[model samples]
Target: MRLFVTLNFLPCSVFPSPSFPYTTQEEESGVIANHLTKHFSSSCYLSTFLLLIMSQRTLLIPLSSFFIAHLLISGAVSTTFTLTNKCGYTVWPGILSNADAPALSTTGFALQKGESKTITAPASWGGRLWGRTYCSQDSTGKFSCLTGDCGSGKLECSGTGAAPPATLAEFKLDGYGGMDYFDVSLVDGYNLPLLVVPQGGSGQNCTSTGCVVDLNDACPSELKVTSTGGESVACKSACEAFRSPQYCCNGAYGTPDTCKPSSYSEIFKNACPRAYSYAYDDKTSTFTCASADYQITFCPGPNTSQKASQETNSENTDTNTNTPLINSTMVYEGALSQNGASPSLYGSVLGSHVTAAIVSFTVAIWQWRQLF
Candidate 1:
């Protein structure tokens, strides 16, 4: 006898369908066998289907908690693409960077798609996040994305927010004329500056990385420059002996990265020309030597009275004091700053700032993903 048959034959209280007419236990067994025919064979697959999907559509059990879990998982650690500006070398928080739960997200919300947000906390908080990366016995254990591509891989990038990876269309750069990135003018800071407009004159949407321009090399070259408003123009010469009368580009002062003929050609001409010093003071644009010390100062406007007094005082001051005073105009010599060095502090600062940009882009993505 089969085990199920033996169970039914024994004193068992499992209730059978009451609609069946069974005067004897043997008759009941036959009824059970007949009724089970549709389930015992290939049709048994229906039982599993019914359990998973009620009425062939609805789930047999509710998944409310799973959706909640999804929200929590998304919000927990979203910063992937991050950039910092201070030194620019902040790396994406690695497994070693976080001691416990990494404070990766900068913002608290994940938007509809590619929208991004920012958040800022004390360095101490960052330290707290950094501390957690190693101490697995502390509390929350380390987590690696299943695909191992959450931070900066093919599937993900250290973009600008803690959000889900954006679909192509969602990465709309509103108000960005089109340029993606550029090296910031050292006049501002050695940095890879973010672009706000489509760089190509065509104004078409940017699709690739070709839009960025490196501006860090702008200085230390012999190229003559003018900055009138906010734009720059350059005048390079062809040789060291070439006087100002033979103004064009040469290795005498500036780098030759420029492809312009060894004559006058524009470095930044698309924007407002007069605003840049290179364009305005074209004649006096050359810097003889980067080793030659020069002061970096916003020329005090003529409208300022404080500068006028300082200028008059410098001119009237005694020349015997070491710093030769001019005839009452205004020029003072101050101690050298750290930015004047062998490699120049500007290069290191620029490196750090660029690293920071990468960090910011990463953290921003993580922040948004966690928030929503």
Candidate 2:
């Protein structure tokens, strides 16, 4: 005997055509037919078919849930960053991922002289990156940095912000209106000059935004961070030097109307026209790029030849020094839509198709057993 089964689990609206007909055939001419004829009664066939169906249903329920959850989670995308060090000295890079997000490769790591590192960030990722100078690890394994220290007493920042007088590269990837917003902010002060350039992207005024000028050279006397050798290692912000309401932009000067740019902030604005001068300097400071990779170059001034020479010398003398000037490129997947409707609809249709497939396979198995 032969058996034919048809599965009809999905609605007409889900299919491309008005209806989808799935059929399966079973024949009593296989090895299972001979075994059943010789060993089992007709009542056994019914029980066997029911048991098989139950087992299949149990397996498919979890599979369906897993598939659905996978689709929902896979919608998020990644963004790439190429962080380079152009200074003659080694810089320990520190990264702080956005709130509630996970940390990347390292919260902080050593980038040897003329070295670079690449990092990938998840969708809607926001964070800040800064360079820590004059860092050392003690015999007890506790680490400390001289400038741009996060106060963690360790190489890794562990969710801490850089101390004042640290140049900062801030980013918000795949953000509002389907664009990535980034800036090289000196609001915390400046230890080094960095440039943030967007590559392979398109948007209005999507040019590079940075403060390449060495603020440490022109840093005010009261705000200078000098080393033991009396060399200025970093530059402090006006707010750091004077904690008054005018410099800090607090109290009566908290609002944008009252907090006009002072002579101090104007200095930074004049140097880096695309960076935030004060708390309310967003009009010209904020920049947007759509689906772009960013390059953050520390100490990106007129030291190209110096950096190259140092890199070559370091490579020849220090065989263990493996960090190169350029890190590998990273590709972030996923495109975030303005509204949530597109992904939701896609998940729904995909789930329905998977459910239909399970139904067809189950029906086919059941029909094949019936023939025996």
Per-candidate Cα lDDT values, in order, are 0.20, 0.59
Model 2, position 75: C-alpha lDDT score = 35
lDDT of candidate 2 over 293-359, digit per residue (tens): 8788876655321221112344333121232222122111122333543323334435535654564
> Candidate 1: lDDT of 147?
12
Instruction: Mark the 10 consecutive residues where model 1 has the least summed lDDT.
Output: 166-175
In model 1, the Cα lDDT at residue 333 comes to 23
Candidate 1 regions with alpha-carbon error over 4 angstroms: 1-60, 68-77, 80-83, 87-226, 229-372
Mind giving the per-residue lDDT tens digits that candidate 1 earns over 53-159? 22344332223333333223212122122221111111122111122223434311211111322333221111111000000111343332211113332212223
Instruction: Write down the TM-score for model 1.
Output: 0.16
